[model samples]
Target: MKIAVITKTIITSFGLLILLAPQRTHAQLVPQPWVSVGGKDGDVTYSVGARALNWGAELGFGPDSATGFDLLKFLSLPVVSPYLGLGYYSEDKGLAVSGGVQVGAGDNLFLGVGYNSVRGINGQLGIKF
Candidate 1:
């Protein structure tokens, strides 16, 4: 199906980007990780994700399982980052677009709110290392 091809392409592109990313002197022990919960059409969905080098990926499970990838850009402001994302869900749901903002709760904790065409509104909690 068309969705299968698109999914493969996206996975390949993300893999290439990771492989070609520049190396840095300091390394992170762990990427920023988060959990998200949302609902759509009375069904709830749960997802997990991680962010690093301005890029993030997530996987959702429940009534509408999906995989998502995003690019996060941090604003000049002290504690806010906004992101735009694309996701592939069940056959019926197909593709979805999402956007959100994340605010740093402190030095290591963060909170986020986002909306997805298929997943509806979500709240996220994460930790930065």
Candidate 2:
């Protein structure tokens, strides 16, 4: 439904950016596509929102696999941006609140660390455009 549309839009936009501009795209390889996998030992719960200067949500993976969503802002800093987020995890019960910082190492390369309300700590590696 609406989720599919939004996903398509993002994909389309990213594709266009990749195709339309090669030099610039290769130089910045930003907003790179990424997915993360991790684990939490204790019981956990929380809800998350991820977008630039905005809040949002997802179904969540619960305790076992918490699919986290993060919002990346590039205006504040160069090579590094302020990261903010909230996510619904599976562990403790459900949703968990989280936030932190994101740093870009190079084109299509970056990593981040944030605090998870349920997991105690959360880490992620990502790419950008």
Candidate 3:
């Protein structure tokens, strides 16, 4: 199906980006923690995650509970960090694919808009610490 192909492409791209990242000792230990609250369709969803280098993972809860892994730091824009993610949710729902742009509000705050295949359109307000 189309979704399967897209998912494969995303995973492949993430792997390529990770392999291309610079080798830095400090980057491996630094964790960027964040909290996100949003709505998918009519269901409320929230997540907490951490990013280190170009990789991140989140535990999410809502109409469905899921765990997601994202490739962060792929784009080097000044104020916005764009990311792509893939996740597996409970119930019969399978893979969830997502992409979003995060805009920094301060040193530790960000706002984002994203769409997930399983979650619908979502707007997020988060704090990174």
Local distance difference test, each candidate? 0.71, 0.46, 0.66
User: Compared with the true structure, what per-residue lDDT tens digits does model 3 show for residues 3-86?
Assistant: 999999987787566457564544435566676677766787777676666566766665656444433443435687677777
Give the TM-score ranking, best first.
1, 3, 2
**What lDDT tens digits, residue by residue, belong to model 2 across residues 18-120?**
3343232223322244333334666453333232221222233335554444333222345554433444444444555544556777765767665655555
- Give candidate 1's whole-model lDDT: 0.71
Models 1 onward score TM values of: 0.68, 0.47, 0.66
**Model 2 — which ten-residue stretch has the worst lDDT?**
49-58
lDDT tens per residue, model 1, 1-129: 999999989856754554455545353446889999988789897778887666677776546455444444322235776666777777477777676878999989999998878778889999988
The Cα error of candidate 1 at residue 50, in Å, is: 0.6
TM for candidate 3 is 0.66
Q: How many residue pairs clash in each candidate?
A: 0, 24, 0
